[model samples]
Target: MNIIEVEDLTTTYNGHTAIKNISFKIEKGEYVCLIGENGSGKSTLIKTIVGINKKDSGKIIKNIPPEKISYLAQNNMIDLNFPATGKEIIMTGVQKHKCLPFYKKEDYKKFADVCKLLNIEDIINKQISDLSGGQRQRIMLARALIRKPDLLILDEPCSGLDVNITKELYNILNKLNKEDGLTIIMATHDLEEIKTIGVRVICLATTVKFDGDIKDWKGEM
Candidate 1:
């Protein structure tokens, strides 16, 4: 099943087109790596797909509910000195309910499951200011996962981390896709980081440059 489909999509801002004639479809349980150079409309296309940016034209057909599709942006904009525990910040990702009083047993269970999945249960209690970049990233990932999303969309999720941590994050994502069958569309700069992870590659340069199995992508890196 096609979880996401974009055909001839276009997005422009201030008369400058960020992405044009973009098209692709993500399968229900497939992991897709979206690759492109800087200023290649990768972010724009991702934002458009997640309804963060308005498209100029074309079509986007999403098979899942909008609320069930979780998105992680390229940047982490949280204040380090916010004086909140990592877990508190992640709790904000849970949608508010009229009858549900803040955090319920099921909510904490979901939190525990998400934390265990990301292997961050040890650090979630630390203050945000004292956490490392990798920890913070994991918290963000946990927040995104707390909703148990059917489709996960991430844009350059590992931007500032070192090599080992990036590898760890990749391993977690790989496990999620391969084991849990979570459909994912991730935008990234380093194709080689995920090139061998059994994922389809979608290259965009303000448009569709290449779309196929990663082994079949012929572009020179």
Candidate 2:
């Protein structure tokens, strides 16, 4: 089933239209990539869909509830210097659920499972300020995963990582999509990254320039 549908969507930033007349659909359990040149609204489109940016026109249909959607914003948007341990940072994701003052046993289990999946159990106790670049990225990803989301959305997830770290992050995402059946939508500027792992490519330039199998994409963006 289509878990997300965008029909003629238009959105703006600072009173300027960033995306116009955009449309697309994402099936459940699909791994979709959004690719585009700089200033082409790739980030705008993703943010609009997730409500970080508001749409001025058109429709965004989500088959799943809002709480089931988890978004990982850009690395610059995160402040690793925040005075919190990785575990403390991650458990905040659980706060959006029931608004309780305390976490349940299941919440702690979710944390453990996500850490294991990301191979980040060793760093969960460290202060975010002390983690390496790769470790920080994994911790943030763990934060997203601990939410137990059905759909994970990310914006340029590999922005500041080194080559090996990028590959490791890709491997983790592949496992999540293939082995765990989580739906994913990621915005990126790398073409090889799209071809190597993404199943579907949605190329955007204000609107969708192409939307199809990743193999069918011809390095358009």
lDDT of 2: 0.86
Candidate 1 structure quality by residue, lDDT tens digits, 153-198? 9999989887888898899989889888999999897676787586
Q: Highest lDDT among the candidates is held by which one?
A: 2
Tens digit of per-residue lDDT, candidate 2, span 1-221: 99999999998888788899998888999999888898889899989989888889999999998888898877667776788999988898887857666889999999889888888888889998899888888888888888889999999988878889888988888888999899999998767765787588888887788889988878555
Question: What's the TM for model 2?
Answer: 0.95
Clashing pairs in 2: none
Clashes of 1: 0
Stretches of model 2 off by over 4 angstroms after superposition = none
Native-to-model Cα distance after best TM-score fit, residue 47 in candidate 1, in Å:
0.9
